[model samples]
Target: MIELSRRALVAGAAGATVTGLLATTMTSPAAAQDAATPAGPAASPIPGAYRYKVGEARVTAISDGVRTFPMPQGFVRNASGEAVNDALAAAFLPPDQISIPFTVLLIETGRRRLLVDTGNGPGQGPVGLLAPTLAAIGVAPESIDQVVISHFHGDHINGLLTAEGTPAFPNARVFVPEAEWSFWMDDGEASRAPDRLKGNFQNVRRVFKPLDGKVERYAWNKEIAPGLVSVGTPGHTPGHTSFELGSGADALFIQSDITNIPALFVANPSWQVMLDMDGVKAAEVRRRTYDRLVADRMNVAGYHFPFPGAAHLAREGEGYRYVPVMWNPVP
Candidate 1:
């Protein structure tokens, strides 16, 4: 098993709490004012990428950026607006608004490198950070050997193509779920899609049409790449999938949109998100997935989780609690 540690870093001085340190340091009014003012214009925050190990393989969590907005009407189909706000408040998040993050996973075995999912393409507001973050970690797009898609969601597929409508990972082979391809590629299904989903049908074509004959469709329970087995985790989409990433004895579950935002959906598994194609079925799968995670004590890496989104789950009452894994500076 991989050695997991939990060590909290102190903000300022030893034995001093952040609040206490601030109180002592800002005693003078001028000191406080001076503290707030920078000597010169500050630079923009540098985006980050995190890497750790899963057995012998190195796994990096590359951020794609985030989307923050006020909670829209019907964001949670089954829950009342008030209930949704309550959940957010319980999680210590700001009420009335939510920030959904997008993260893509890179798994590197000594022999090959694989990307789990792509992020929202470039130029998307507050997103499209995947490319830069990858570069930040010294990974070039061309070095990726395989691109494994979790589902057909725009956020997960958009990064597959570049601004020029060319394959982003020019040298990589693309693998998609067989079920997902059949559902989205069928004209009959596209024609019957409701207005809200009509755009999704068109968008699917827009992303995949350029990769025709270059794409390889995969099935459930199969190893799409070495040590990476595709697991059928439908409901978010008819062909939505997850993966069991095992290297040696260490394993991590790459949960792709199993729960959109952990605070809202993971804590309240029964509450359905607007993106779920089949809310009821999505709920069922979410519950089942969480139950397994809890029982097996498996660590998970979520696509929409906070930056470097990797954690462990514990059963809390009728739902599950998210416990983030400790960051190891050297892996």
Candidate 2:
């Protein structure tokens, strides 16, 4: 059994509360400034990045950028677009646009450097900034000894290859979820999939073909790497997974795609996403998992969350709210 220390839980809760208040206060002022100064120099706000210590390990969150698009029909299979838009509006986001931010984490555990997931590769626009971001932190791609993937989604796997379609990390071992690999590699499954989803099936092959036998498949409940244990979290994909990163008395849950956009889905765990292969099961898992998170006061890192992506979940008026941690300028 895994346990969370009382001190960590209290700290996370306090951090979440402060963050929520700060975000609420800052958003209005920022938006007003943006509207009033349209012709001002477009200087970049300090990068969305942060670092925190989880026991002996040092975790850094790097931004790969964000992609915003109209909320696709059936985006939330169980809810109407109007309802989804309402939720987005409440979060001070545009009602019609869905923004997905890509965040990758670097875990330095004294002896080893581990990268959680690679972002969409170069040629996809600013998203390929992971490589440069890593460099900015003084860690080269070659310095990463291991790459642990939660699933085979394009945004997560595309960074495995460089813009030229070659291995991005020359000296890293890739670990993929066994169930995910099996589902994607099954020709029968692909043949049976709906026309709309066949592209994902094709993408899995394209990304892994060059690696050939180099990729290692890991099972749920196993430690794919030091201090990183894979937990079975399916429905988004056959082998979709979440990770439990623990050291001593500290822990963080790496929830990759468990909720596509927290404001919309996390606030309404019963809502289903079109990307969920099994919507009903996904909702069941989401509710149960989040119930536990709320009860345990756990800190989570969401892949599609705003940059840095680390947040503390809290029960809010029959749903939940994601309160992002403050950006610590010094990492």
Candidate 3:
């Protein structure tokens, strides 16, 4: 057996070890700088890419873009902005505004190129950068073997089509939560939904219409891809799902829309978001899910987190805090 250093032994004592830890330690600072590297006029903003190895697999978080909006009244359905601001203050963020960053991960497991959730498509202001970001990382959309969607929300599924309403990933198979597909595709559900949600219903049809009979609906607790198992996380949308990606003894929870803005939602999970289809259910899921994350010391990749949204969950006073993972350049 290979000898282990005292430090390594202690860090790995829990049967968890990050691959290339030494290389990450040595190159992380430089990597952080590289993330902010200036882009040429024609090049999309430096793709905000981050890479880490999970056992033998390579996971890269590619930023689509970010959107900032004024805090809408009832942004937090159950709490006031002042109350939410306190949570934001604790996270060192502005209390009056919200910034949502979209990130999609590319997982290369030697056998497959899996993309977890496509970002907002080109129409949503500067948020549709996923395509260009992928290009910047030397990955063409067609090269992806699978496109996995966590839900049917516009921001999550709009990127499925291009500006001209074409399949963005021509060669890849698209997989989405069965419940999401069922809910969105139901005319009866759409008819009863509020006016604000009617657009989402139509948008879902527009995005999926071109791919008729091609979309694959997956259920909870199923392995949509190797090492990628879907966990039923509802309320944000009836079918919203989180993923547990395990490789050997390492794992990462892709918490898709579990919380929108970490400063507000993650820090004050009890506070409900207006975007949640079922506010009470969302809060319950958020509280219970985050509690487990804190207790288990799981790394999470949040869809709306800051760029390259990988972080460890830490228990704070009432809720929890997100500890961002340091950048690793050499991986």
Q: Give the best candidate by TM-score.
A: 1
Q: If scored against the real structure, what TM-score would every candidate get?
A: 0.87, 0.85, 0.86
The order of the candidates by TM-score, greatest first, is 1, 3, 2
Candidate 1: 10-residue stretch with minimal lDDT: 21-30
Which sections of candidate 3 miss by over 4 Å?
1-47
RMSD of each: 8.2, 8.1, 7.8
Model 3 lDDT tens row, 1-331: 0011101000111222334323222112112222345322322233356667666667877777777788788888888778888877877888788888888888889868989988888666557777755654457788989999999887888888888989999988999999998999998999999999999998898999998866898999999898899999999999999999988877788999989998888778888889999988998999898888888887888988886688888888898888887654542
The residue pairs found clashing in candidate 2 are none
**Deviation in Å, model 2, residue 99 alpha carbon:** 0.9
Off by over 4 Å in 2: 1-48
Instruction: Give the range where candidate 3 is weakest over 10 consecutive residues by summed lDDT.
Output: 1-10
Winner on TM-score (1 vs 3): 1
lDDT of each: 0.79, 0.75, 0.76
